[model samples]
Target: METSGAPQTRGARLHHPELSTLVHTSRFHAGRQPGATAVICEDRRLTYADLHHRSNRFAHALTAAGLAEGDRVAYLGKESEHYYEALFACAKTGTVLVPVNWRLTAPEVAHILQDSGTRLLLLEDAFTPTVEGMATEPPETVVRLGSLATWSSRYDDTEPEFEATPDTPVAQLYTSGTTGLPKGVVLAHRTFFAIRDRMAAAGVDWIDWRAGDIALIGIPGFHVGGLWWATQNFNAGTTVVAMRAFAARQAVDLIRDLGITTACVVPAMLRMMLTEPGVGAEDFTTLRKIVYGGSPISEALLEESLTVVDCDFAQIYGLTETGNTAVCLPPAAHVPGSPLMQAAGRPYPGVRVKTIDARGRELPPGEVGEVCLHTPARMVEYWGLPDRTAETLVDGWIHTGDAGHLDEDGYLFLRDRIKDAILVAGENVYPAEIENTLESHPQVAEAVVVGAPDERWGEYVHAFVVPVSGPPPTARDLHAFLVPRLASFKLPARYELVDAVPRNPSGKILRRELRDRFWSGAARNVN
Candidate 1:
């Protein structure tokens, strides 16, 4: 009911007033159209006013629980209005928000909570087993996030004073790396606002928010893509349908049933949707556009999706460090079976993209090098890792470990990853993370994980293991061991028993040497 506000003047306010932090975006929308439907999840539909009030109450709840300004709060659950409530509440109170991956194992979850020094954890009931089993120090304070209605009612709707300034860190996103444990990337609220202002200034109406737009969010909000995409629609005062978890059929049905104008997802998601039963061409009739990224969509899949889905598709190219997307392959560039489709597109306004060599000097177009960018939304620093932060963030530029080149037409084309990371359905699975799990097995002498070409999921995990003396463990044994420790996506699709793992003279595992043969025939190293 009254979801659209009588077509407000386009590009009303790029950033929230005064502080220019994400803290007040919901309040601004609440002031614009309090009655408009803001979020739809399961049996609940929250209006803009509801979102503002609820988030404000949640903020009060945080303070009442003894949370101080800049204190860390972690959310370990699925996508729900409560997550948004906590997210916005953090912005208002200057508390740090950490959306933990619910899919991670107990130890994985504990590591993030401990690393961030999270004072409190807001968890759902389903994940009780995961948290209850954590080996590390459990959070000092815990709140049942899903059952917050009764608790929040005790607090007033008075908005928490906006405390975080433009340069203050708002969110901490943990990202896995090839060399060590997951690193937390600290992002400032101004970064999000700056990125939005840049995108709005570009004048790409197809990608920009407008009246009557209904957004279906399929990605998990824990990831940068999901949070940024959802916030983009929320700021636009559009009706947002946030999926609890991604299911291809659910997405296809929602696109038709909810008359969703646009959806943001990755290539692997599209592949799954196309294969789902009853997912016909007519099911996508209501969709005006589909924004896809993370990893490149296969040419065959892209052609099939274009034929079946009667809507323009756009591609976003960026990373967790870059806030979200800094560049985009617009709908106009979505020609079926074209070379341009292979490129990652040009940089957005306020973002400068270039290729740089080992010397850190900019390379000319067409020269392959590390694909780096200077975005207004760059992460403040890697939490606690000054050396790593220095290595990645140099002179206001993000050194994306991706090796790629720019074409004559300024299109950014990805070639390979300079880091040993496997892209499993848009989620990064570091070899070290998996290898660490594997080496822990008493029977396993060593293990190596690499991305192998996969038709459906873009690239699936493939592990090569060297066993200790006796007959090696079967795939079943390995699967059983991994099922409880790692996420399903990170589990190897297939395993190979090897005599010895490839290693350099210094005893470091030579992963590229092992991957060279499998990827040599492919067009690019990355799937």
Candidate 2:
């Protein structure tokens, strides 16, 4: 990471020990660096003062609309200053902000809105039709992105009259569950700042944010990866350049034009940007470090990134439930032809990682089993799903549904997912969610979904279907049927007609049996 120059007087003290939550940071930064740019999205720019006052005004508007502490306020839109305004607004009022992926189908969007018990939805103008179609039961209040400024202009810009602590819930991000539905992962303010504090205490500089750093956030704010990265920059009082939606060409231009010093992106994004025309070392001169994760990086891609982008590359590994990243492979380990390239980085300070057997017994190093993480960054619980929360979080340790082992050096080597979830371009695609939708079709008697290796997307969804009787449904027919029911990424890229889905005596469908066919020669179970 690029080191900071002489620290600005009042701005340097914005990181006071008392500024533990968003409420504190927002207020502190506004007073310290009112004119400093906090966020940049296309034509919109929010200075530290603008972010604080606008969020405060919106917080009053939320209260005026009868949203009290702990109420859920949802945002269905792409990355923008508005999303962060709503995020900080929610934080100031003790309300939880739920950021929905804008790419999801109407039904998928409806599920998140209803499941979260959302009181108000702050929507983008583009999704008005999608929300209108959800006539079933939508949120009580809906505010369009276009009118947010005018609506909040009537309220006072002063800080809201509410108390917020480090443990207050701020964000409730939904992650696709293995049971065919998405569950809300409730995160406290501490979750956003825990790893930073840990790193400072441990004197670790693996992922440090410096002043004057222009950080590019290519990932949308909906995902934890995006949210965490953005907040980390915000907490450090750095300028954030957020993309409305990731396009390879735009990303390349943004880095060169905006002079982005650091970036956090998935490996797929980096790959796409490299393929853009005229992309060369000149496009990355200002970039000092690039942190990538969401899925494993291929050796070829890693080598190419090092040679072409020619920047320090750090790899992070974690789930949404872990508040983004618990493990980070620092820039020092990005050497080509090294075995460390295949390993997920070591856990952050104050984070504990171990492999556990099916019986919940911790295994020794080099033994692959279910990976578990105990970190202060872990989520509070799976919102409103006590039983599900119990199943995952045991004794403060999250039983990550991943199969991995730690080397003697403490680097994690992920073998496969213990849960049958597919990582397509960075979004989690659960097979059960697709299977449930597929089985709803008249021609599909039974359906199974599995992740197939893909060169660009890391993994693609593949479906094996058993017809009810007579002629089987063609792949084209199935694709059309699923277009409006599931997100585009969740749709199967390939389909096969099967006579029967293999099952155990207990009637459990053998997903592994079908999945193994496509992964026979792969070095790892996941792409």
Candidate 3:
């Protein structure tokens, strides 16, 4: 068996030419190293050969059911080997894979399916009722996760005849809708491999894959980070261990037992694993690197991680539109007490980043403005939304609604968010979504949502509500009302019943005024 390890030559392709697309990536590995481990999810272990054959069978099944190029297929379930098989099946058949977060409410799931024009839905058995309750227009075909193997078995394990281009849309990931409705972000096959190719050409090992290295997928497949990390490992012909869902104790056990070499996680996940009961340095002996992002790591937590983990720590910063990570704080700058610790590192090779003022003019270093990024890994567009796409992606640069300044040396320091999205344990929660739900309550006349700093979970949702003429509803009353409509992460941890919300002369609710109360003593408004 021949496995392509870490890239060794500068200005060379990361892998063979055949690995351009996800379908070709699977075929290349299966042909070169058939028996190599591809994915390990709980009790299930799938080899490269198995993955290739199973995905081929699923692809055949999809095509047999009339799904053709550019069709959308959604997967609503926990992370598992079947999910990867479905993903590769979509890649092979030239269909778009829409991964729905299982934690979402039924209405949320339905919105993604309807919004994406999903033709088929592959879901877990537990969510059967969830789909059945979608009285409105649902997916045309629904296949339970357990029956997929049996259903796909009727077809032969032959590769699909269709070939997807490098620019072909393969995945459509939904973002937490900043405007009360989530939008699907369409990503091409190139988004996964472009950064690796750039890194190989630049001879950089900031985030590298090596021979005999087993990687852990701490993030879920529903997020771009998890999918990108998994594909990066598969492209390198390395083994991957995926958890159905992230659990701190299971992560610690996997690191200790599976000889896991590298893992990608968020700061909150790292904190949980580090603080897991009976966890210590001895359990992380085989771990080599931890790539963390989604939220910045506090100095106290970073110091504790450095002392206990005894491994290299790297930070990644980007949005779903940037295909997970465009800026990486490499391990070389992980020195404790150094000023660089507070900065988000420079862009990867073949990537460009800059800050711009409200007038759309580029700003010089030391000037705070909206952060923008341009990379080969950028998403194609927000599905079915031309105006939204134009507003976000201007002149090939993604206008990340984040407020930050670039230092003289090019290290990016994040100050706050230009938009009103809350970061709850690395999950994006829009304020408008929560405010809309709160205002739906009969007793609530008006509502304002904001993000409040917290030691755990990074930030918690805080809501201010104005009641009707009669009696006002308590925080508990609103919490109970929202439980069925909103995801737990988006629910406000604290609520204040006010006679009137602070507003400007134009009747625009003053969110910053209410938000400033919680962040008065904090160094930066964003947690």
Candidate 4:
């Protein structure tokens, strides 16, 4: 498959089978590479043969325990090798796996479990306290994950027969709820495989993975970043080193001790790792590639990362609906002063990107507007939300609410999210552009721009900043730095210093929270 340039056809569909049945591919490779390590956890290492056989046992156990095909089973726990076993066990039995984020509060986790109508909840022992006292709709069974003794003794010897067809729903991922309550994004085997194939065809060399190559999966499996990468690694016959939870020191230690070559992380994780003491070029000697996404990274941090980490950096740009990455900035573009480093790079081989205005008219290059993406990897629909599905997926294009522009070279430059845009005196101001300018200041460590309610202008830009490792800059000093970098209308009217900004697990700023502070007493949520 070609990994560069445009796709040959407009309506090209993926050739991979249903995702629930996709486990068979890994199982087949498992027998051929029985001794090859498939997963390495804190204190456990499972070879390909072990993983395949154990997941088979898990499948039989689920069936014996009354889990039928298409039954929803939610896995609520932290990242571990057992998480993969639980995930594959669902696929092997044709059950839909719903991985609930452990970072969420018990109430939030309960809401997801309830919404999915899960028949079983598989949890880790470490998180038992969090779920034990929570009021939730009781599933048919509550099994503790990672119990080898129980799993080995429980199920029948007969091999269970199952196949995951393209139409079979493999997983239901809930939205990150950046704006409001989370909604389930239902994906099938076809969608998952399409994304993997699309990514491989877009310059990602998955086939180059050797049986001995160790891949680090630090991100939680609940997010697309963790789930998709793990699946891809498994398919490529590579071993995965699972981190139970993300810790800067742990990540560094894993790389050094486990000989981790490839890893996927968000910008926030990278920042945290860089802040750790004793972290330097020598720490990441075995590391080959670091794929980063979820939010825009500051240019300063991006540059510093290249100097600090001894590995190639690839930036990806996509949403959950678009199978995680529809655009990729390859390793070569990570060059500090390169123009491609500023843009999000061109669209993936199988994806088509366009800019459009409010009326849906296509905007010319260099025109800032909503980013519209067309790809085979686009999600089929939002589960139970037909109206929202229609509103978002139109004319074969997913209307990404993100506002950006494509340069003449087809490089994408994100301005701001449409919902985050501040309307002041009838002029549109993108907070990202202003925040990016502000973050470039020598005294600014981090900056979040939000729209504050104004009696006269309707809404004005409000800046919240975190100072660098020096004397804090006053509001006036920040304004002076931003004045020349941005337009007069875009300049923030109110400036406040914050120790830290509220960010989601994906590192996206919670603009709604910033807006909520100014409109606390008001009826409506937005300014």
Candidate 5:
């Protein structure tokens, strides 16, 4: 209904259809282009027709198992053809898909399931032990990937009856919480379609898509990078080649062997790919476009990737709440001398971005402030947190809690998080959890964790600790103790023994002072 841009308007429609619109699109494309490949998983290949039929079967199976339209289904598995089928099946049945991060601990997985009120879970057999040991029993329907035959037989007799409306919830993505626990961000079909349409209008060209075009998706499907890119390409009738897990050599091999033309990866992943042995010119010849995001890519890494991949590189910026990419630095802007490359690029079509001060007053161009957004692509709300939702969304703008400035040229430059959260390797590391864990140590009196610039990862977690009774625990000791308590990525990388943490008169840790050390020579405060 909203018409903010041209290409978006062409894709937009007045009717609110069900989430199954994706399935319908797949079927329509298949019927029109039956021979077109829709997915490629290692040795397996599936046409659009194959995907449609399989997803229908999967949807029917889900319905017969007593799963209804509003039920939450958690997917805890790696990227594969099956993952796509499950996602489309959920969309077809109007069930919400909640993809669990494979890196999380058993407890973290259980927490997500319970928090999201998931009734059914679809998992790969490899993770059977992990799921079986969870504290709470998810819904009785636990379908393992390898045993689909047994599960599918249980529901084959039931008739397929599924209809999804545009208002139906499509996904509930959980974000790393800064205060307490992670919160599920509820997103509807309209939000997804709006973002997809906006992205297509801004730069994506589906016409370039062809039967032979192969997309290598190296990032985990649990993350937005892999999930959205795969979906968009699949809808366009392109073959998507997924890697179960990210390995630099494996990715290069896929490009060389599979003739993959496009791929999505983070800067860290790109760095690792360049470091792989035998990584050379020919390994990258098949690649035409390499999309990198999730964190700022240093000029050095960007240049290195250009040399290794021989492809146009594009940068995207957004969070889970913004429906993947709200701002994109197009591939043409990757010119070595282009000043725009230093910015996060312009806002995606139909996405309006503005900088606002603490009082919510709009700031003039080039002035740093909280970055807020107005877009139909924005999440409906943070699930079960009305007060938090109100705090974030006001007057149709979603306060990003990110500090940035928009230049006169309309390029966005990020400074820091308005909420003072830390980003390490593109993963959010909240200081509250680290400080709480450190303070729990009997030998420590007080603790503060902050982000420090690192060449490898965008930032690394640094902890400042004050001894209580005996000598403060060593860095190794603290890391060992925290590894089991928190996600590995959330653990502090460096430990600084200090008499006291720098704090304000009101007793708030001065994270700015800690950040200054690493960013002293950088043009921007952000690493």
Candidate 6:
């Protein structure tokens, strides 16, 4: 959870105070509070001074390896002190840090590596097999994270001379590829500071991180929520206690034992913790506020959570392209039976949101249209995908594929996702990616994927397949085919043999129609 970097005037300051760029963020806090603990991971604790020196040495190590400004460095591991080190080190040296999700299969992992054109790959020892199995050429400077300590110790503890600007790409977070292949969302140093600075200027006390704030980092670092949330905790001079892997019981224990004052988690994690045995209101007495996003929380889960927890609940809505959260549902808005709880909340101080029709004209309130937004924290561009960048970011407004309507009071109510995506436990699962694997089977002719109503997970992957003019393929046969190509979570939870897949005139699969057939009599479009 520790982030930020060395003493280096490597950039010009933006509008934000003191620390405008990522490089300055480190020097400002470390100089002010050197002895303060920055991170807590199991038995390891890193102070601000340690964070500065270790990141300084790591910056030199990366420089010695010939990774200069704008070079891409990728990390394939879970959340760790090492992950944050690489993030800040890259921030200081002006290199782009790409954290790939370790949950991806060899092929999906290979695509990100090849697409990003990574120069240095910082990998965990456990992921060696995945990297080795990839057909693509691996990055030249591959350093196993298990030995990262020994590697960085050889370098100098001083900062380098590479100048990074406020607009310099600090990180490239890959979206889950809801539309097609995932595009790298390029975030600058200024992207991290924008929202906080705006909130301070406007005197919005929605998510102020106090000095004594101890944040529990629960989400995976590969996602924007995890990485950006940790960095913000550091920027505010708060300590971050990160969990390597999320378990319901352990999370409750960490809050009880470690006194986690603030936490950023998805709705799924909260749902599990509410049902975890022995968890009660007393366990979370120290928690002041929790910022949750990625998916809308069910009313049932919210009611159960509030029953056992007496803390401020803030709901956030954003994508990887937006840096983190652009809109937030403040604690006061979470009433038990109100329309506000169903809405995605209002925008931050400097962020502006508007719904637009296909013609790009702004739609009036209550009219369902595409959610478009403009914020200081918007991504620079989709890396190497100029066409996609143009399509998504038009005239500085990002067209979020989500179909939602803004109320008179400006709360965004999400109706449906325009993109063919399945929100499975807060993870985006594109049917195209799954269909590609299912159709690869010899016994399958055509395939269509959709999300079905799920109890534990919000929506689980379900596939409909048309068989080749022979015996119908068994679920086991299709499962075996996808085992190697897809990750365990991406695998279809249910399969239905169909005569033919439903498609429109232009050969586009009508996934919503297919979903409706199975989701009949359901209270809502559950996904």
* Global lDDT scores for all candidate models: 0.81, 0.86, 0.86, 0.78, 0.73, 0.82
lDDT of 2 by residue, 313-423 (tens): 889999889989999999999888798987899999999999998898989998878999999989999989999999999999998888888999999988657678788
146 in model 5: Cα distance from truth in Å? 0.9
RMSD of 2: 11.0
Predicted candidate 4 versus true structure: per-residue lDDT over 422-473, tens digit per residue: 8899988998888878888889888999898888998899999999887999
The candidate maximizing TM-score is 4
lDDT of 1 by residue, 432-493 (tens): 55775776676776678888888888888889998978978888899899899898988999
Clashes of each: 0, 0, 0, 3, 4, 0
After TM-score superposition, what is the CA distance of residue 177 in candidate 2 from its true location, in Å?
A: 4.2
Instruction: Return the TM-score for candidate 1, rounded to 2 decimals.
Output: 0.79
Candidate 1 backbone collisions, by pair: none
How far is 398's C-alpha from truth in model 1 (Å)?
Answer: 0.4
Q: List the lowest-lDDT window of 10 residues for candidate 3.
A: 1-10
- TM per candidate comes to 0.79, 0.80, 0.80, 0.91, 0.76, 0.79
Residue clash pairs of candidate 4: 3-201, 19-189, 21-164
Deviation of model 4 at 86, angstroms: 1.2
TM-score of 5: 0.76
**Per-residue lDDT over 386-421 for candidate 6, one digit per residue giving the tens place of the 0 to 100 score:** 999999998888888988889999998876566666
The candidate with the higher TM-score, 2 or 4, is 4
- 1 versus 2: better lDDT goes to: 2
For candidate 5, give the lDDT of residue 308. Answer: 69
lDDT of 5 by residue, 1-527 (tens): 43221122322321222223565565565565667678877688887777777777788888877888888989988777888877878888888899887766677788889888888888887777777788877667788887765666544422246666666778888875434677888877666567666554455531133335688887777776677777667655567888888888888888898888888888768867786877888788978778778765555557667766787777888877777778878777778757675678778778889999878799999887899888777788888889988998887788888888899978898766666667778876767567767766666666777888878888888888887666668888888888887898888888988898665321235677777777788897556
Which of candidates 4 and 6 is the stronger one according to lDDT? 6
